[model samples]
Target: MDDEAVIPISALQHYLYCPRQCALIHIEQLWAESQHTAEGRLLHDKADKPKMERRKGVRTVTAMPLAQPQLGITGVADVVEFHTGEDGVEHPYPVEYKRGRPKAYQADEVQLCAQALCLEHMLSCQIPEGALYYGETRRRTVVPFDTALRALTCETISATRAMTVSGRTPSATYSAKLCYNCSLFDLCQPRLLHRGESVQHWLHAQLKGE
Candidate 1:
């Protein structure tokens, strides 16, 4: 694949959350903002502003553009803190801001780890960990970029890239808990579509048996 074909790091998170959602957003360019999404956007907006600040021995840069050609993923980091070690070595720690509380899934962690991977590639340094700041709890949770997470991140990248290039939106699978809060709820109409498909399949089966 050409280096120019860069996939958004956000797609990895979206794909993990829901492949249909990812395809709808990236492939079809469909989007809607719900209260949750708006809150998340506001949180990201606050972090996305380009700025630099120093705190004690740590220097922080906000909205830093990060990309890894090998992974074909690109996105701006919310914050990259450069902490000076006792040995005078500087370590980069990426911190991502989220609107909601932590979830059972690895979507948020995968996103954070992808940022760390980008930092590793761009700076030619290894990052062992990063953090996710959740808006609901107003607390930062540290995440380790371990072997499992790294492997998952890579897999997500490849899967997301394939979905993006395929230009086909995956069919929606409805979940009341998830679809209710999704920004694209109305647009996706997961319940309606899935129900309609189910009915169609049932009718087809009846006709085939006749």
Candidate 2:
């Protein structure tokens, strides 16, 4: 992968969560850390710190560099736990730390899948699964290497590559649902762009000499 073109793994998940949010973040370069992001950052503060520790069943390495060049993605793994199997085979499971509970959306999945892909390429092993630890729930959610999610993750990577190459943020397609919690609502101006009868309002007024 091109060192300068290193893609943020979060962008893949962000696109899956909301294309508008993805565009606002990666395309328009607009962002603000709300309560959710702040909490998440605080959680990551500890994870980002350098560390190495051993537990009964596993060894933990924090701030590991993970990426999948074939998919054009890269990011830092929060933690990768080393486990030894019954057959004496060593396995690496990348664990992503999240600040909130699991969502119906695919954001977290996409991020985790990207990490799995990265680990696979890095280790030359088939990463069959990974896990997400949510701080709020204090539980680890295991994610299997299913075909559907992998496909979605690949599609997301391609879409993000296309977005960055296009170098143009898409116009806001007004939708109350998408704009509700978006950090870019004000900058995107979905309301201003789509309101008052659209372009027809201006054309009609001009033609009638109003």
Candidate 3:
């Protein structure tokens, strides 16, 4: 919660999905791997290792470290492709790996844009776009670093930083689809927590009543 604390770039995506989930992981340091997370881990295994390759005027770098101090974000990009133009200029394009199909939200894109922001800072060039590679479809979806998405990504970063400073894990709000898919569902106990208690608290109360 220090004023100078650097938020993990991953927290941006997490916060976009669910602020409570973000706080639970980053602020509370709680983690549990569910099937979904396990699959994601596997998918990222190749990208997690740093490597580089060159082909046909394009250079690819995997597991590239990225950080933007102005935005207070630091993380690694899954892959970054540098394309050479006829003008002999090279453009850096980031590619993010996802374990599942694209979500109905902007979480994935924002994360990719954050990587581009880092590239811009490090390379001193404008990164106009990036891509998201989904595991399920095995296809790359191009994402433009448009004004709207850029603004939203910045807002999410500020909001997430504030949440971290507050040092409060938000109370659970249950959604059948979201909560059911969360890896921390058991630890979160969204339904019970929403009722103003947790499973342990309810169990203790029941024992006392006996």
Best by the TM-score measure: 3
Residue pairs in candidate 2 whose N, alpha carbon or C atoms collide under 3 angstroms: none
Full-model lDDT for every candidate: 0.87, 0.79, 0.89
lDDT of 3 at 5: 68
lDDT of 3 by residue, 151-207 (tens): 999998899988998777777888999889899888777886644344445456669
Model 3 alpha-carbon miss at residue 92, Å? 0.1
The 10-residue segment with the lowest total lDDT in model 1? 194-203
| Candidate numbers, best TM-score first, in rank order | 3, 1, 2
What overall lDDT, based on C-alpha atoms, would model 2 receive against the true structure? 0.79
Candidate 1 vs candidate 3, TM-score winner: 3
Q: Give the CA lDDT, 0 to 100, for residue 179 in model 2.
A: 74
Q: Which ten residues in a row have the lowest lDDT in candidate 2?
A: 194-203
Could you give me the TM-score of model 2 versus the true structure? 0.85
| Candidate 3 residue runs with Cα over 4 Å from true position | 1-4, 194-210
lDDT of 2 by residue, 79-179 (tens): 99889788777799989999879988888988988898888899998888999999989999999978998998888888887876676555556778767
Candidate 1 lDDT, 91-156, residue by residue in tens:
999999998899999999999999999999999999999999999999999999999999999999
Q: List where candidate 2 sits over 4 angstroms from the true fold.
A: 1-5, 194-210
Q: Given candidate 1, what's the lDDT at residue 120?
A: 95
Preferred candidate (lDDT higher): 2 or 3: 3
